[model samples]
Target: MLHKFQQFYPDLERLINFIAISDEYVAKAPSQERFLEVIIRLEREVFGTAKMRGPRVASLRVGEPKNLRDCYDTYKAQKRETVEQVTLELETTVRTLVTDVS
Candidate 1:
């Protein structure tokens, strides 16, 4: 399963691109969540499955957007020129996520 990442894309390349090119507030993301997200993307796209590391590697394939590369590239481009807008958007997003909308 790990080999899938090797087949799909280079880790260094993806990390470099994600950190250098991503426009999202991914750097501000909670550490564990960020790690999970990165691992999930790498596993699903490259290995065709995702799983936790263990004595037995149980992986399952999940659907991924064909435009993943595009999405990633766009996300990288999402930087706000103004800090105020960036702060407000982050606050709003957090609020929405926390709000109960049943």
Candidate 2:
């Protein structure tokens, strides 16, 4: 459990950092899904869980760069939509909780 926790943040941080500077990576991808595949693989490697691949396509690979840009629209629209929906839900839940507390 401790090992899992320790690995989680760094890996997730790497994912965010990779996404931030991923223009070069995404540009090199043969397809958007292929790029996301790279991300999924990284997540598994860092987190040691196929579950991290989540609902995203399970096209894991090694030594490929990926990005969030075309992972939607040209890639997988549902992934973006899912993220947006989750963001909205979290925001709404937080707002409601704050309002009730006050």
lDDT string, candidate 2, 1-102, tens digits: 888798798668667655654556667766867676666666565666535334654332232233546445633647767677656766776676666656
Q: Which numbered prediction scores highest in lDDT against the true structure?
A: 2
Off by over 4 Å in 2: 1-77
Model 1 clash pairs are 22-76, 23-75, 23-76
The per-candidate count of clashes, in order, stands at 3, 0
> By TM-score, how accurate is candidate 1?
0.28
- Locate the minimum summed-lDDT window of 10 residues in model 1: 57-66
For all candidates in order, the CA lDDT equals 0.56, 0.60
Task: Please report the candidate that would top TM-score against the real structure.
Answer: 1
lDDT of 1 by residue, 1-102 (tens): 998767766556556545653425357665656656666666765765677764444344333224434345445666443445555666676566556341
| C-alpha lDDT (0 to 100) for residue 51 of candidate 1 | 75
Q: How high a TM-score does candidate 2 get?
A: 0.26
